[model samples]
Target chain A: MVKATPLAIDIHNLSLWYGDFQALFEVDLQVKQGLITALIGPSGCGKSTLLRAVNRINERLGDYVRTTGEIHVLDQDILRNDIELAQLRRHVGMVFQRPNPLPLSVRDNVLFAHRIHRADEKFNRRKEDEIVEHALRRVLLWDEVKDHLGREATGLSLEEQQKLCIARLLPIKPTVILMDEPTSALDPKGTAALEELIWELHGDYTILIVTHNMAQAKRASEETAFMLLGRMVEHGLTEQVFLAPREKETADYIEGRYG
Target chain B: MLTERVQLSTSIDLDHRGRDWYTDKAVTFLVFVGGISAIVLIIGIFVFITKEGLGFIAGSLDVREFFGSLAWRPTSPTKPTYGILGLIAGTASVTGLAMVVSVPFSLGAAIFIGEFATGRLRETLKVLVELLAAIPSVVWGFIGLSLLNPLIIDIFDVPVGLGVLNSGIILGLMAAPIMTTIAEDALKAVPDTYREAAEAMGATKWQVIFRVVLPAGRNGLVAAVLLGVGRGFGETMAVLMATGNSIKIPTSPFDSVTALTATIAAELGDAPVGSDHYRALFTLGILLFVVTFIINLTADLVVRRAGRK
Candidate 1:
């Protein structure tokens, strides 16, 4: 038997509806292991919705929602009813558009994931310090926040807060991280910094990011998927997708003709 | 050309004189009236309370005996004791008890209504809580007398239904709705971003409520507690009916007691004119006024701090 490299996420023939309105139609894609893939689209193109569907976070929105499809994460069907949301979410962490740190000390925000998900009380002061230090260091936020770990997280700058959120996600050791327009609210310098961090993190984790900036998609991703009107118009290597798009719509969007 | 320019300038001046001047004056006058009315009302009420309370503070009347003595029997001629210590202690005990009973249940209900329930269920629970607030205190008192008092007495094997326990329970029910409603509003005012952040970190629903939502709305929660305390302190009919109108300090939940508002309401109609008893009732009124003032001031400070944040 010929063996195939297993994909991290596989979505096959997925359709989603919010009551009478259909949002996505027969979307198919694959996320490769340990690489950064960017989903680029205009506003209202269902990019964020599709990202939310991978972790089943959309199911918590309301009862009127209906989804017909199969989504697989780590070779396990995640759309099944028996799939535990908490466990799935623990493995698939997310960062939102705006930086939303808890109204707590910086240290607590970093350790929140472990405290909530891990039931072990035996991790004393030394282990806790190690975990906090490692998580913050991974996101390059340890030195800036080390002295004021006891200070409130809300008092940080927007860039620092977003990085703190990333640090928070790291403590859970998620297999994949989903970012929805992570730098849309940031300044140019902040955006460049976060882009660098995303590239650095691509070595160890699968990253699926939704961004409207074509340059950012081109810069940070190994693979890029272009979506328009809730449909995936093109999916290929980042270089090929930008230079030689298969569809005219993808080329036009990348060329800034029409969203 | 010069004549044309002068004519155009004159028309512009006429337009401004016709509409702008009158509208601006009317708006300014209306604002002045509204602002002055509010200030006057506040100052007037303060003046009234202070005028009545000054006699008790002045040395012309004995302050030590009035505040320190135990007995509150005003009609006894031989050794009439008009101490406010017992009444003040009684009021504090009842108010404290009412808060203890109401705070937890009201907060739980608020969290459930605001964060946990589905759309229709949340609407239904909210309607019920609003109805609870709308029910008159006198009606609550009647319910306590006819229904709750008997039940409590039977369950606890007490001699009478009217006691500290009965008043506290009734006041708790009366205050719970306000606490729940205010707290729900506070919880709802917390931005969804905070909740989403917590949930994204794989936090359980309960943990999100306790860790993220509650802390984000701490100032509002404190305001709600203060509002509930005010409601419990000023509650008159229910406390009067269920407390057995006792003047002694309450030693336990089963003992009969009286609160400041209850004392004023129960004795004001029969208090003799220009007598020490009348002055003492005014004094009770002063105490109630001070309590409400302090609670509202604290609430204002908390709200301001939250706004600054």
Candidate 2:
């Protein structure tokens, strides 16, 4: 077996606690550059928490949280107190499970991210429109939303809202993208569309996804990590893990004996 | 045996009827009393103010002078006069000053408590604000009179602390609790999704508060401000104690003035019935009614619009 080289994000012995409730326990994982890694688990298994930890967004929970060990992103220690969470977040953008576009116009939602992440860039209305249009086009949403660019983003359909959210994140040009059950709230058609977009996005950005759907894990990622009760059950190439999981727990979970 | 059974059946039937019927009647009576009392009181007050003030408003009372005049004196036996311009000006000045003083601080505290403050600190700060709100208005008035009033007088001058400025400062102290609490509620009412969305785009905390949270809470904050303005405008004892209660237009924060509520409280006593002086006090009541009604109505409109979004 040939392992990948130069991990984009390296997590070492990471443990997390929300007050007395431990969420992640001594979990170690590596995500390679320009590839998708899926963290799959049953509900309450801390897949989302582990994904949030990679970008240090878990710190937003405040003092109730206690995290130990290190998270390295591009050879930099992301867990260090000195790390700028906002800047790190800009580099590692997130897309939530629900479609959460701003209250502003669709055009403004896309421009807002660009304005925040790239403040030094000159404020040109036309240039902003171009950037927004390009992002919308990248998500295959431009044809649907182009005429209604000035409409409130909340007015969009659920699928369009999710696509708009994706467009909003793209303008920042983040190197890594974290998604927490991105299509869990969508219908079959919307979910299929989002899956295709995720596949396309894999070549340009390192993606870390947390999902409860086993089929989605098989379809969307190259590597898979299975977790159970705050512990890593198995982690390996997607096909190998699904076909011949090394651990008994992994085998049981894959075979639908228990989660 | 038949007679005994019939007597027993009649007695049981009477007992059941009496108890159940009486209970239902008592409940209905109580609810009716409470509901009717509230509606009657509200309508009664409105009718009384409008009826008493209408005659004076219709006869010889110049609306322009009443609103725009610089002097307000409705207490002269020989040459009686009545004009609300000074009181109106005073109300505007005090409320404006209070809003200016309270708005920024209240918004900052709201954002801090709602967005930035974490865990125990957030809880502590919230408790402190609630305690501040719990303090009685008269107690606040007394504190302002004894402590804040004198402190300002000594620091700035007697005139500066005993006028519109003093009234405004006292009202600001009173308004701060309402502003912070309501603003905090408004900020919290903004969905977590908005914050998450903003953060995901790498927006700073300040940027998120200003651009997203504040705008989203615009209507609620406006309602908060209107409520605060109503409280400031209608406050009697605090303004009466802090303001020197002079019936003159104030030039600056450093001059004494009388608000409509203060004027009515001070002069309603000893004004003979059916006199212009008496009627004018009722007219001041009318003015107060109009001001508060307008403010509350505007607040309702804003809140409705917010709900639509």
Candidate 3:
């Protein structure tokens, strides 16, 4: 008997429209368990839209955002009405394009989602400290921010702030993390540092990162999905897709032609 | 060629002296005058009030009695006393009650307008609130006299309905629309990014607003409430009619009271131009100016602190 591979996120024929402007059309993608999956495309190519679709946050932009799609995260169909958004979000955390640490203390920003999910639980300060420490350490930010836990999170540099943003999601025990251009705002050094952090975090959580940088997509992810306009052109092992692209459009994009 | 180059260098005219430059200079001058006029007018008013009230403060006025004694019998026949303790108490009490009435309603309205209401409803509610603010103060006083008076009497079962309770409710209603407008602006000033961040964290809509938006907008809300309190303290005609214009320290909401603004509005016309009573009233005007200045300063400080954070 053949062994089956586990999938963390399975999206099927996903289509999204912001009012009358359709941004994504009939997109299909599979993110395997415990691996980094990078979605790369030109601007307005719906890569970020697809990442946001996994967490189902695009609908909150406005009621006019209409989506006809099936997005299943961790084998659960998130688009169905029976799913509780709060519960689904607890399992699937997201990092925005900008480093948006809450306007709170570093300790509170990490504790925020944990507190929300565990609202009914008895208060335990020791456990909370442990959670904060573990989450921060997982993002390799514990030593940098350990002495200044009470300081405001927004005051941190963009690189540290982005790390803190990812750190905040860890306490919730999220199974999947969707990142939208996680390093687009970082400097070259910051980007290299963050990529190191992502490499360190692999095999523990399934991460889906969208990036405009093709080099980053190739270097960081095990699997790479190329999108054009609103459709997924190709998705394969990162090395194979970048080295011997199956499609002519994929080859042209890789060669830095028209974005 | 060298002579041509020297001539070209000599003829270089870089100064912008066209009609646009003249227009810019004229506008800069006009705006400077316009801006300075406000400061000049404010200082001029302060100087005039101080000059008018100096005679009383320098001569026969007892500073202690003006603030300490409750006997505000300014027009007494034999021993005319100018004690304003009772008026101070009355004004403070009515303003306090007005704040009590206005804060919840205005904050709730602000939250609804800023967070919940959508599309046509939001615009409609905003326009309605502005319209409410535009209603004449005299009309509000009339509402207090004719509408609220009988209603309070029926509800509270009191012999007379016009008092602190009446004026407080009336002033509260008068202040509420403006407070809502300002509070909405404060909430609007909070970035949408914070709300998005909270929502993505699995916070329900209420949790997002209560935890993130409210905390981020705390200073603006406090400033809004302070501005509302300032308005309540300075209001005149509405309180004059609804307060029944009685000079006494109000121990209860039912007790009739007179406010400082109401006293001046009622008696300044009858008092002779340069009498001791006139100077006393101007002294009250000086006090009003200082209190309002302090309130405005506190609001500015709170808003500036928000900027620093």
Candidate 4:
């Protein structure tokens, strides 16, 4: 008997509109459990919009954004009217294009999500220290930042700041992590470092990353989905999509025909 | 090629000698005058006040008697006491009470306008709050005199409409717009990413505001409150009309009192030109200036530090 793979994010017929402009069409995609899935697209192709939709971050754009259809992350339909945004966000963490660390201490930034989501839980200083240290260590940032945990997170370099952003998400114990061009702000070295970190984090958590860099999608992701305009044109194993792309558009995009 | 180079050089010279150059010079001259005028006015006022009041500062303005004694009788034939303790206390009480009334309400309004309200509602509420500042101080005093006096009388059964409480309420109303406007600007200046990050961290609206936004905007809020305090302390007309000018240390908010501004407004005209009373009023003016200067300096320091962080 063949084993069936459980899906982490099951998105179906999802459409999003900003005012009169439709940003996402009827799109369907299934991201597998404990795998790195990359969404590749040209500029203004709704890659970020689709990524934000999984965690419902696009709702913060205000009432102008309208959505129809369903996005089920870990079997929960997050697009439902009765959904609690805070609860939904706790299940899914996001890292933005820029390394947006709050103007707070490194320790405070790492503790932020935990404090918010688990407000009722009893907190001890020792436990919190462990959580911060563990999260930082997982992101390979513990040694460099341990001595200056009280220093403002913004004081860190962009590379370390991006790592801290990822580290901050771990304490929340999110089921899926979404990255909207997470390494776009970093230099080449930083990008390579962050990609390695993301690869290391695979299998423990489902990560859906959006990238404009085709090489990054090929180098890091297990599965790849290509989007054009507002539609998911193709999705399959990363090697198949990049090496022998099924669609001419995906082939052209990967071959650097147009960005 | 030679003709083109010559033309380019001539055009550059013409650009330097253009009408925009004259306009720039004119603007520079006007701004320079505007900047120097404030300093000149301060110097002029300082010289005038000190020249008239110097003798009292030099001789009879005993620091102990001026500040320590409560009797403010300057017109008495036998004992012309110039003790301004009553005036200073009145100013402090009025300003302190005004801050008590204004701070929380203004902060609430600021937060509501800055964080809670949506597009049009936010803009409209901000404009309306700021419009409150445009209302003349005398008009506010008149409103308080006509509207609030009877209400206070009916509620508390106070003797007259005029007192520290009455003036403080009026002053608070006057200061609210300034506080709300500056504080709203401060809160709004907080980057949207902070809000997004907190929300994405599963924070509720109030939690984001109280924990993240307010902490980031603390310095601006402090500056706003200090500026409000300065406004309340230096206010003259509304306070003059509202607080019945009964020069004494007000034991309660209900008791009538005379602030330094009100004292100067009421007595300076009646006193002879160079009498000790005139000099005493000038001294009070100097005191008010120094106090306001210190408050403004503190506000500047706070704003600068906030920018650095």
Error of 4 at A144 (Å): 1.1
For model 3, report DockQ.
0.74
Candidate 3, residues A1-259: lDDT per residue as tens digits? Answer: 3326588999999999998999999999999989999998889999988898888888787778888879888778999978888888889999988999888999999999999999789999999999999999999999999999999999999999999999999988899998999998999999999999998889999999999898999889999999999999999999999999999999999999978
Candidate 3's residue-wise lDDT over B1-309, tens digit each? Answer: 355543335566788599999999999999999999999999999999999988888976997899999888777778878899989998999999999999999999999999999899999999999999999888999999999999989998998899999999999999999999988988998898898888888999898988899999999899888998889989999999999888899888999999999999999998889988888899899888899889989988988887677
lDDT-superior candidate, 2 or 4 = 4
Residue-level lDDT tens digits of model 2 in B1-309: 365553345434444567779899999999999999999999999998878888788885877777777656566656655667778877788889988888877888888999888778999999999898778878867876788777887998564567777778888878888889988888888898898788767788888988898988999899888888888888888888888787777777878887889888887887777677778888889878888999989988987888788
Candidate 1, superposed: residue stretches over 4 Å from native: A1-4, B1-35
TM-score of each: 0.93, 0.90, 0.94, 0.94
> What is candidate 3's CA lDDT for residue B273?
91
Chain A TM value for model 3: 0.97
C-alpha-based local distance difference test score of model 3: 0.91
1 or 2, which is superior by DockQ? 1
Q: Mind giving the per-residue lDDT tens digits that candidate 4 earns over A8-126?
A: 89999999999999999999999999999999999999989999998888888889999998999878899998999999889899998999898899999999999887767898899
The positional error of residue A81 in candidate 2, measured at the CA in angstroms, is: 2.1
Model 4 ranges with Cα > 4 A deviation: A1-3, B1-31
Poorest 10 consecutive residues by lDDT, candidate 3 chain B: B1-10
Per residue, candidate 4 scores C-alpha lDDT tens digits across B1-309 of 355543344433433477888999999999999999999998998888778777779877889989998899999999888888889989999999999999998999999998889989998997898789899999988977898888888999888878888999999989999999989988988899999988887788998998899998999999999999999999999998888888888887788888999899888999898888888888888888889989999998998888777
Which scores higher on lDDT, 1 or 4?
Answer: 4
How high is the lDDT of residue B200 in model 4? Answer: 80
- Residue B264, candidate 3: alpha-carbon lDDT: 92
Docking class of 1: medium
lDDT of 1 by residue, A45-137 (tens): 999989999887787777777899999999899999998777888889898898888889999999888888878666678888998999888
